[model samples]
Target chain A: MASKPECACGDTSAVAGGKKRIIFPCAGTANVGLISNAAAFQLADEGYGVATCIALLGSADTGLRRRIAEADEVVIIDGCPATCGAKIADLQGIAIDQHIVITALGIDKVYERNYTEEEVERVVSAAWEGKGRT
Target chain B: MKIEVLGTGCMKCKRLLKNVEVAVQELGIAAEIKKVDDITEIINRGVMLTPALAVDGEMKVSGRVADVKELKEILKG
Candidate 1:
């Protein structure tokens, strides 16, 4: 396999009032998982910070780990209660600033890959509202 | 040169270690390869994914297996 080029040079400067945030979406194949992915995109598009790859973080990719470490806030958009993203982050000693479990937000986890934009918006709005904040 | 296979003793991790050994032998390079199954050590190495390859402390790959050819290229470098 070809070695992947490392994009370790990410903008570490604060985006949201001196807060540099990174979002980790579970991005599972299931519906809730898809929602999490969509929400991440929306969040990034809304200038909430960049949406990052969970696999790279799980692999402890050097550049990505550095980015996570530098970020003021680390958000995990887990698809379900299993919280795979959070679990992965924990293993890497990543201190999560905000945790959002889609199922916990009163959204049903349908096996089918069907989710409306509103559902994605709900997660995005929840993120802005700090609903998942401790 | 020093090479390390990072994993938690999973089947795939062992397989990667074995593959690396074969690659070194086939290439006729005198390289020392070690299996890092210790969790703390692996974490300190900055790896959360198993079956990872590190050449001289630089991570080559992780979260997936690389074939003999790929290992050979990494070793050659």
Candidate 2:
């Protein structure tokens, strides 16, 4: 049997063919904040989007801000109502396509440092589902 | 010269401000320094990160704290 060719279509990690999507997660101290960060990482690992540092956005790194401004889609995941992630995007005048607050997903906020895989998945799904909405 | 430190009043922001002051004092430069805490103004100035420094309306450093040595170098330019 012949070996099948490796399909690398739509691989953002390798290529820059299409519009880029950027994800910013609020890596706060709270458990919910950590969950959002985990979810953003998972989404990026799954090739849903590229997870970027919220601090970089907040700091207004010119290169990073330019990338955010030029990105085709921008998603912000905040852990709580503080909405630091979203606020950074808003302050940068970047249009966010999706804004997910982990607490609003029925996840209680705790001042812990760990989060479960399932909790992370739930946030990821919510953020993913938010895509393609008019 | 006009210098502005932009941040949301975070610890790093305060530290950056202090560093800037120290740098200014050491350099003996008669520069006007301002602290920008308003989110709207910060955004309008295209600064996304707190602890950002702008010299004469041009962003010089951002997203991290610059030590006195680093601030001196940035201000010397």
Candidate 3:
């Protein structure tokens, strides 16, 4: 037996339109960076949020500020443990609903041809699962 | 080809720009490298990743800079 009621925040929101979901990717120069981008892309494709680069967020002329202010949910994907994406969001004072670190899961840091899309997808799913908890 | 490494001038972006230049020189290709710090233009490129490398008008790579050898291959292509 399962309940059929729908929730927007997966909690208690009824109307689900323009929730303004946004994802920030660290996009560093390592395996974790690629994973972060992959995860962000998947999240955006899944309609969880708009996938905007953290760098863009840091430099945009108040556009990033606007996105942060209007975003109902903000997700950050940082490669490795540096957490640059998270740091950027923190500096912007934007509360992140989901923060994902690929290397934190025991995956060795790498770049170039050593990384696989499957691993990135796994991390993205994990981030998605952790959503709305922030 | 004009290549631009887009980032907030982070170490990674700088490093990638260096690699791109090295590759271009090694391959004896004629290109100029530019660093873009404008967030609006970066976002306009629809790149959701930093340390992005653009070849000419196309985004050749993003998130990480490829190795010198790999960069050479990409540039040669």
Candidate 4:
């Protein structure tokens, strides 16, 4: 039997692409935070960019700092208007190319983590559509 | 008591040094404050972020510039 063709589609770890993009999601305990995290994961699975932790930047991780500096585009997703992810990026001197707030998308910020895939897709589409450009 | 300021000479680091001095003076504690300016040395001490405060060779905080009030709290406790 002939070997099947290799399918590397939607591989978030595929670094061979021309432009390198990294995403920082506000993975807080709230619903909006969960939404932001889920959206980033879906986007990463779709080969949009690699999803990374914002806490590393908060702690000033040297390796992650260098990666952020080298990335072509850095996306920051905040769960609410507080924009904790954006603030961390700023504190660590990391420039943000896109800043998305889930609350601004008409998504209510709730303490419970009850987010649907539709909401996650909405955020993913917002990222792809460049709606979060600051 | 040994209070070390770990940084690579950023503006915040300079501010942190001043804050540390004032904190020590205000508390009237016999503490030796040393500024660690080398990047490699700072990282070797397990501090990737500049403008960090280490008390008795223990990492307290990093990345953010803690205010004088916060410094006092950290130093005292």
True contacts kept of each: 0.00, 0.00, 0.00, 0.00
Report the candidate with higher lDDT, 2 versus 4.
4
Please give the DockQ score of every candidate, comma-separated.
Answer: 0.01, 0.01, 0.01, 0.01
TM-scores for every candidate against the unseen true structure? 0.56, 0.55, 0.52, 0.57
Encode model 3's per-residue lDDT on A5-99: one tens digit a residue.
22122211123232456778888877778777877887666445678878877775497788578667777887777888888777777788777
Write the residue-wise lDDT of candidate 2 on B8-37 in tens digits.
776546656777887899899999999998
Against the true structure, candidate 4 reaches a TM-score of 0.57
Q: Which of candidates 2 and 3 is the stronger one according to lDDT?
A: 2
Candidate 3 docking: what grade? incorrect
**Ten contiguous residues minimizing lDDT sum, candidate 3 chain A:** A5-14
* Candidate 1, superposed: residue stretches over 4 Å from native: A1-16, B1-77
* Ranked by lDDT, top first: 1, 4, 2, 3
Worst 10 residues of 2 chain B by lDDT: B61-70
lDDT of 2: 0.74
Score candidate 2 by DockQ. Answer: 0.01
| Location of the lowest summed lDDT over 10 successive residues in candidate 4 chain A | A1-10
* Pairs of colliding residues, candidate 1: none
How would you encode candidate 4's per-residue C-alpha lDDT over A1-134 as one tens digit per residue? 22222222343233222246799998888999999889888877755678999888799998998888777789999999999999988888788888999999989998996888889977876776566866
